[model samples]
Target: MADTYPWQDELWRQLAGREQHAHAYLLHGPAGIGKRAFAERLLALLLCRSPQNLEACGKCKACLLLAAGTHPDAFALEPEEADKAIKVDQVRDLVGFVTQTAQLSGRKLVLVEPVEAMNLNAANALLKSLEEPAGNTVLLLISHQPSRLLPTVKSRCVQLACPVPDEAVGLRWLAQALPGLSDEERGELLALAAGSPLSAARLQEQGVREQRALVVEGVKKLLKQQQGPSQLAEGWNAIPLLLLFNWFCEWAHLVLRYQLSKDEQGLGAADMRKVVQYLADKSEQARLLALQDWLLEQRQKVLAKGNLNRVLLLEALLVKWASLPGQG
Candidate 1:
């Protein structure tokens, strides 16, 4: 069985120890919060041949099978590719799996992660399976954005919310999880992740910190007439489109915050603070607000549809960003 995060220990005990568990569970939470790992641990506890203290006995046949990812009675479903939707055929296969008997004699388990990735057709296909309460089967649906799921699908299952930990707790966990990080780097990553420790660790591992530094510097150079919008956009072509937009949105919010309160606390990532402050001082307050709205709108459009021309959209935003200083 995979070990769960410290914050998940209480919830794990509650769900694992319960004899009358729900047939379907909707575990909803922010991304990178370890909900999938928690669900896996619970699934293992359910399938263990000889459970020990409401947890899995790792030496059991069931545990060994699950560890090997060859468990006959268990199925894991998710998007076949990154940024793709889960198709109706996948749910149809799940429906077929649900109607069958458990081969392990203990119970059958199905794990669906990021369930919101399922399209309308796929979600409708899953309703019947969720409605049928089987005696020896459990369905675990993990969602980062539960609001995107159909209400009918959500209403059928028991909902378990996993919340972001407090700043101190998140930073403490990050400190141990990423031992090489300096205190400043740890704090910046935690803030950027909005107090999700696992997300902060992933950001560091993915070099988002370095990318953000480059982006911030690019913004400064754009305002100072040292770089052109097309040049900056081309240089930023390697950064994920949504991620770049999100950072732009965050920086814009900080500019607005500084305009409103003249406080430094509104700034984000420590490395970007100087650049954000520079923009806040030189840019028009009203223009900053309008640009912030534009960034938010573009971010939404990009997220909803994947077919947009990334380079052109980014170039347009950078052009607008470059004009901010003179707009004042």
Candidate 2:
């Protein structure tokens, strides 16, 4: 298709000025912040045989090949399966491609989305190519968890944090992609999106939107109840850890907004005021931060081979959240 990059003018300008750009670039950021799009656009810029000023000339042979997904010099690698790590064989496959001449005799674009998904052997296997890459073959390494990548992998090239777009930008973009949504629907979607147009777009799908709303409503209900944390935790233990992360942050955002506005906009109608207020008065922001770390630790623990009682973990979180006020 046409090459129209919206949010990355300066990076293009910088790349244009460089006489010898680095071969590897690590694009790291939170999910759906347009890192993938940035990588794709940068790939086009690198492969474009001809460009008008800083933008890729979409009509060129290289651009057309990219559009058609037939660019022999370009490749993309991600985890071959969900929850299955990338093994050494996968990384080793890149060796021949990295060593060989580019199909266009110009630039080869090798993009690895979530380079952190690579196991140790796979990561080390890819090291030689990063150390002695073929002439002008760019490796755009994209990772949500870049810290998992070896320091050697990170040290070799540019690392850029692609932040989320502004709400208005995301809203406008999402509106065009997600038609038939009311202004209210769009607004809620924008809040749920957390400045991510991609996420807002995904929320347009019927089942997903309904599911998100259900989860939010469920969490709201959970937060308002009178039972002890342990008892209250029993009813809803099946929600994904990430979903818990999402809803808790949303609830906290609502409370913070309520604190700021003292209006309907900030109010959590689910009557979570006492619990949230209790935490706000007693807990440091670090305690709030610890929620994510604790959740992740549990996720990895479960992922690696451990069975955690879901209700108990949720109870522990609530009790920790409850008791945070007195910590030194």
After superposing candidate 1, which stretches have Cα over 4 Å from the reference? Answer: 133-135, 281-286
Question: Tens digits of per-residue lDDT for model 2 on 98-214?
Answer: 877887837788998878888888988998888779777889999887767799989886887766677777777767777788877887776666666776666566345566655
Off by over 4 Å in 2: 2-5, 16-19, 206-209, 220-240, 249-275, 278-293, 299-328
TM-score for all models, in order of appearance: 0.92, 0.74
Worst-scoring 10-residue span by lDDT in model 2? 1-10
Best candidate according to lDDT: 1
Q: Report the CA-based lDDT of candidate 1 relative to the real structure.
A: 0.85
Candidate 2 lDDT: 0.69
Clashing pairs in 1: none
Residue 284, candidate 1: C-alpha displacement in angstroms: 4.6
User: 194-296 in candidate 1: lDDT tens per residue?
Assistant: 7788889999988988888898788877877888888888998778898898888988888778877888776766767887788888888888888988998
Model 2, C-alpha of 119: deviation from truth (Å):
2.0
